[model samples]
Target: MATLEQCMTALEGFVGDLAARPALSGLDRTVSCRLTDLEQVVQGRLVNGTAQGMEAVPAGPSVPRADIRIITTSDDLLAVTSGELSFGSAWASGRVKLEAGLRDMLRLRALL
Candidate 1:
């Protein structure tokens, strides 16, 4: 299994790449991630530049932001990151849970 730090690094890289995508430009959003397996919470905003830590997650109009909460098992992270697991599947299987307003959830789906 990957260490929590390693998983965090991977997530950071994934977000960074997402931010760099042209289609994602000007998409600002905040996603609070809880890695149940790792027992960690990562909160950040999607922005133009890379974010290092929680504080660096952007929160501005250039990137409209919304908060997202994700709950999942440890092995689930690996599955999600590897594309072996889909968010819809995990949610349906009760492997992942999300708590938020309907609007926020929909916005998150688009941002993420």
Candidate 2:
């Protein structure tokens, strides 16, 4: 298990990388990462490959769904961001769950 702060830091680093990816260029979408272990969701917007205003919120119906949704544990999030676990492996093995539209999925494949 990882602490909320640790997860936030990991996500920040991950988003930093995401912002620099040419594959994500010109893509704009809202993203939510639901951390099952902490029962929290980190919400943010990806605008032209840059992450903006990311914040953690409680997970519940009150939270509106984002265009891109990711469900996983804090540990898995840490593992992926730290390169201890590959994103493709995590998604394939069910450690990570990604929900997005077909177009977004195709664009994201380059990131994996």
TM-score per model over all chains: 0.63, 0.95
User: Candidate 2 residues 1-112, lDDT tens each?
Assistant: 9999999888877876776689888878898899998999998988886788889999999999999898999999999999999999999999999999999898788656
Question: CA lDDT of 52 in candidate 2?
Answer: 88
- Write one digit per residue (lDDT tens) for candidate 1, span 1-112: 5677666665676567656666656656666566665556667777654543552222233442335556665577667766788767788788878776776465446433
In model 2, where is the ten-residue run with the lowest total lDDT?
A: 12-21
Clash total of candidate 1: 4
RMSD per candidate (Å) reads 6.6, 1.0
User: What's the CA error at residue 72 for candidate 2, in Å?
Assistant: 0.4
lDDT of 1 at 33: 61
